[model samples]
Target: MQCSSYWFCPDVWTAVILLILCRFRGCVSHLKINKYYTIKSEMAKDFPTRAENYAQWYNDLVIKADMAENSAVRGCMVIKPYGYAIWEKMQAALDKMFKDTGHVNAYFPIFIPKSFFSKEASHVEGFAKECAVVTHYRLKNDPDGKGVVVDENAKLEEELIVRPTSETIIWDTYRNWIQSYRDLPLLINQWANVVRWEMRTRLFLRTAEFLWQEGHTAHATAEEAIAETEQMLNVYADFAENFMAVPVLKGVKSPNERFAGAVETYCIEALMQDGKALQAGTSHFLGQNFAKAFDVQFLSKENKLEYVWATSWGVSTRLMGALIMAHSDDHGLVLPPKLAPTQVVIIPIYKTNEQLAAITEKVDIIVKNLKAKGITVKYDDRDTYKPGWKFNEYEFKGVPVRLAIGPRDLENGTVEVSRRDTLEKSSFQIADIETKIEHLLQSIQDNLFQKAVDFRENMTTKADTWEEFVDLLDNKGGFILAHWDGTPETEQEIKEKTKATIRLIPLDARPEEGRCILTGKPSSRRVVFARAY
Candidate 1:
């Protein structure tokens, strides 16, 4: 005899046995299943490989790893707790660096008077397209009483522009703050959110609203302002390389790519795993442009009144996107230890309560010791999910290190350790486990940075002619060092043809004579070019 539910029961006898068991156990009541099974092996089946679809793989990994998701509002995202935690770590580290550099934190109004923007013509022109304006202040009930409507009677006499970038408004305020050379070099940094009405947005990469830190400084001399600009660029490079474990090339932007109204723009560009470049951070030397526009005059030590020299520099949440693209793998994120919120996770494998309790006791000691060493550790001993499920969760989320111990291991006084960067696993004695893990975390951090450095070195190449440049960009897709005629027209033409732009002119670039790859005109030095994010 055969059962009607053949999938569940292969024979009538099996069905009878299940029914009898159900009578006593109530079927599903005693059986526990993990809620995240969908994201485990089941979702892995549908996960796109990086080579198959790099963009889709990134989108899927962010969502699957519980990092972030698209919000209801268009061109915006809801960063999940896990994602925000990582961001918080970045913010804390950066804030310390800013304070160490003689910059004090301050706040500025989010709504700038429309007239303020008009003071700097080029600044306004650069951000005009992305500004969000507030016209009316109050909302009133609809006449039909369905919903609220903008109150026509309450319209503001002067329109306000949402802060896309804070140059205009900040400079306007500086006019009143600077009266003498003693008041010069007002180094202020603001950690705040700004809105830019972007038409196309990607999570953490480009969004309508984002959080950042902007530093605005006033100097009595042009040399002082230029020094400030370069100092901040170095700060950004240090944070990117040491904290985030991303290697970057320090350089200056071309005239076409310079920040609007800036005399010079300095930047750090990083190479991603997909052979694309990302501008990790930027600093701009305003060179008295904003001060002159807003009439922010300071009395110099020489007893002459003159416009103050200015510098403004910033780094935003876009670094999150860079971190993801640089180190994550097809399985999920391969986070560096310095930036991983949970640097280490410990799980216990057990079939019975007694066994679990024994493992937990040993894990508690390890956790305390690791925390004393200032490590962020999580000991997940939830019984609702099996040990295997938790292992997959930590692996996918990119916890730098993981440890598992069971009754057998407890008896043997050993634990199995696994590292996310290499997916390498080994058994180790439980004695001095915390010391081993601390060393291992540092090893992982160093290993990840070295791996990225190796990748960038292999991907970067030189192109001496137009054919070589185009071929490298089309097929090779990394940094292409090529000659340009040092003209905006030639740069624009190159972009129109190949969809690639100059990433930067290396700061250390020597004066090598060559011909422009496109125009065959005389050129000074080779600039780094690539298709970018």
Candidate 2:
């Protein structure tokens, strides 16, 4: 029952007071802005400035937009269709990759026995607070006929907990499946739901229930497990950069931030427009924790029982939040071509059935060709809405490329193509439409990744002193790259004061000579630190 009930408004006092005045005066100055966009956001203070209020901006975006809503239940969200569509696109892409990587999809029970969670001490402890346990099944009506509740007689001997992660339960079953070394490398990935109760919930960012894929691999040795972790991490990084068009910092989580019961945790971190960090994905090298806990052993060459090494990695619906903030603009979302459900959409503008019929006929031909090439194409022929309104709707939904065909195009043999990312429009001959649109989609994807990378490069700052570090975090805080002295105390101290933490120790951050900004202890290299999702 413990869940994040509400979020205290973290906006500045001046901004809050201004919104009050503007509400009555109809003046945006009260909201600290010059004018209003519509009504609510007009004076809402340009995303609260990442340096001044990073967390607030994230909250504002989630609630202001119709992406998602906080549920009546704590820590959970009611994802709107628009938001769910984005996640569906992400799932389609990642699922295809998993299948291509020699992995089989499977499902596991949502409720795990409470004792099953305790099999791995660290894992259980880490997730205990967030777990939702089921104690009773059936409830009987009271004599007063008020409300029916759980029936005590129907209770089971072992209580069930909503799974926070599936490692323990998955491994417990694997023991029965693995009889020899032939079943050593078990490649299985499951697209499922997980619950992790949070003290605070923000739409897709940290909801109690999220949809994700958990890839579990049972390897014969530690080396194989490590290899699998790195491989999947790379796969995630590649997909994020190319398919989702998001630039990410692939890195290893520090011991404190690492996944519970994992030897090493690899992750991909993306910087949002708010200059805060979001962990887009994580891969863990779980040496032998689950294997030993579940007694999953194999007979080696010498006939001795040897523990199996395992790896589990995942990326969740939270990536939808990251994607929205990373590339989306004031208008709405901007989807990359690969992840977009429709690579191209044809909106025919017309005044009559003759014109409409002509447009639909030609659009049908174009769609046929696009489909022939295995491209996803959508044709909007709804007449109830005006072409302009439809344009705005599709733009908000982030269709990668929009193709417009008017009656004039029929005579001229040309169509207008617009890219959602850049909002750039171009005219093309009808014959060249297919090839050009394909090229434009690829170009848009590349441009988005490049833009994200450029932002990350520019926002990353290096601080040599504690004052400088704190100042940067207070002012331009994105990713503060610096030496950590590699201690937990310093990490805690920084987070307490600034609400920022070591997001990750990047995989590519080269060794450098420096002193810890907080501890003044000797250090070798810089790690990425930021306020994170």
Candidate 3:
């Protein structure tokens, strides 16, 4: 019974009969194998190469993957269903974290009275250029009858400015509530949209209208407010590192970059693929500036009246931009498993409706088990798209895991699993596939974070001399650690010469004795400088 080959076997009839039986049983698997190879060949040509043009590749992937698109309004974008779903995942995770940390959510008005802007001189100066004014309350028919025009009679006694930030309005309301120190720490967070009339904009990075959560807190002492500010900054850094899988540098902003009217600003800065820095989130210590402006005085334990100390912190849709640039590749977005909208997508591969139905039955069981474990699974059983097309679509959309179940797989008690991060395929026994996938998702999250951390370390460099700084900025382009003269004038001169600004004075930077890289003046510690978004 030693058969050498099917074509040249001494027991040719026996071999032929065995082959025929195998073909009849495994025909679906053979067909799918062929289809998978064909799909891989076509996927190579679908996206722009990152080395060729990173910006174009990013723009193409955002739209092709159904993430977002420019809206009809001049500097805004409409987040599509897929993009919004990912954002919702982010919101859910962060919301839970906020609640666990003793914070409460509240709503605030979108419009601030025009007079409120003038109350805080420094805050107004910082945001004056970007404020959008609403002059009238209603519109009336034009005399020419072509279109409606602003009605002069409908003008309000005072105009309103669409809120660029909630500090002024929140502090005004807080004045009435803070008569006594029992209301010492007012921990309120509002998830709302704000408007700023930007001259230039990008989708999530800078838009006229954007969604965000702003936390405004009122405290009785300056120390308490500062503690709250630092606490929120740490929370943002943790979320960015653990959930978004993006490593960040925690630091305090320079005076030039501090939030208007705030005494100090704490921020988390992240590096992008193109050697640029992005401010992922910010927390500001207002130090009673807004409280004094709005007359928010609290009676202290010593029976003395004092202005309340304050802090305001926020992270917006801009985080969406940071997430996209930090881990994505030329192939498309590579989302962290913790933040992927659909953690698993099951695609059935079959030639006919009957085959698909059989495969779907097996997939349904897996989906149910995964859902029970809190994993989001999407069973793509659409007849309009082929299995190959569906695979590519989910890959572009950054689904963390993809499972393929066909008739052959059903018979073999196995399933094909593909990871979006590495684009590698493997087969797992169906006996405990759900548990295996849960472990795989965790591994994917850790792997993405490690990869980003490695990239950041590679990109970060230290420069001791002006020549080295110039070369790094011109060619290497990432975060450059260098000593500064500790003057805003020196910082500006460096920016004018090299277009690289001091991103931050890193909170952990050790004091070192060295001359300034630009001015040769005695320096205390190095600051992070980079071309940033």
Return whichever of 1 and 3 wins on lDDT: 1
Please identify model 2 stretches exceeding 4 Å from their true place. 1-72
Model 3 Cα displacement at 79 (Å)? 1.4
Residue 171 CA error for candidate 2 (Å)? 1.7
- Best model per lDDT: 1
Candidate 1 regions exceeding 4 Å error are 1-43
Q: What is the C-alpha local distance difference test score of each model?
A: 0.84, 0.79, 0.83
Q: Write the per-residue lDDT of candidate 1 for residues 432-498, one digit (tens) a residue.
A: 9999999999999988889889888888899998999988877777789989999999999998888
In model 2, the worst 10-residue window by lDDT is 14-23
Q: With candidate 2 superimposed using the best TM-score fit, by how many Å does residue 532's alpha carbon deviate from the native?
A: 0.6
Instruction: Give a tens-digit lDDT track for model 3, residues 93-122.
Output: 888878887899999898888899899999
lDDT of 2 by residue, 1-533 (tens): 11122332222210110001111111111111111111222323354433334355456556555568888877688887767766787888788888888889999998888898888999977777677677765445544555443456666688788788999889999999886787778999999999876565667877779888999999888888898899999899988988878888989998878899998999999987767788999999999999988899988767778889999999998888888777766555678888776778889999999999998888998998888877899999998898888777777677889999999998898898888887788889999577777788788988888888888887789988888987877677578998888988888887777777889998887889899988889989999998776
